[model samples]
Target: MEVLQMEVLQMMTPIEFWRAGFVFWTRAAEAQLEFASRWICAVGLSQRAAQTAAQKATIEALRAASVVPLAPNAISTPVPKRAARKAPRLAASRCRPTAH
Candidate 1:
């Protein structure tokens, strides 16, 4: 458990954790489906409930990751400006910024 926690902490960003969580849930859902189809007796839980529980767990993990501290002064790239006018972009040469 300690090792798992360490590994999860070592991950760079929340997005990476979210992506891994997605993969984990995908594999888990597949495994659950396989098990349900092969087993004759019910596992005392409905298939829908099992899937919902798995999804809930994954979402909780994501939420926890979202709150973890990141760089105090993180800088993000600014979004590019969108054309406001309906005129053709090619014809609107004046609208474009002058290249230095």
Candidate 2:
């Protein structure tokens, strides 16, 4: 058991460990949400209605889980404007056609 633990620790960096754990938890949460949605539908709710309810439930779940939903004004940084450059012109006499 100790040997196995050491091997596992050696296999992943801290970032990788956290990323893997996050992915696992996210997927588990999503599965739970899907199950809840399916259950709602099974309880005689119309498919479209169930889907709408599920979407609201998902938003609430994500908010409770501390996952911030994207909004229109979410960008914190202003985009930098690029300096315009003149396009290079090639001499027609120097241009050569290659046979494909």
The model with the greatest TM-score is 2
lDDT of 1 by residue, 12-87 (tens): 4888877777677666655655554444235566767766665545444434445434343232345568979775
Candidate 1 residues lying further than 4 Å off, grouped into runs, are 1-4, 7-10, 40-100
Question: Over the full model, what C-alpha lDDT does candidate 2 score relative to the true structure?
Answer: 0.73
What would the per-residue lDDT of candidate 2 be over residues 1-100, giving only the tens digit for each residue?
A: 9999889978999998777766765776688779878999889899888887776666665555654554433343466789999998779988788889
RMSD for all candidates, in order, please. Answer: 14.5, 12.4
lDDT for 48 in candidate 2 is 88
Model 2 vs. true fold: TM: 0.46
lDDT of 1 at 58: 43
Which candidate gets the maximum lDDT versus the true structure? 2
lDDT agreement with native, every candidate: 0.57, 0.73
Candidate 2 colliding pairs: none
Q: For model 2, give the 10-residue run with minimal summed lDDT.
A: 68-77
Pairing residues by index, what is the TM-score of model 1?
0.33
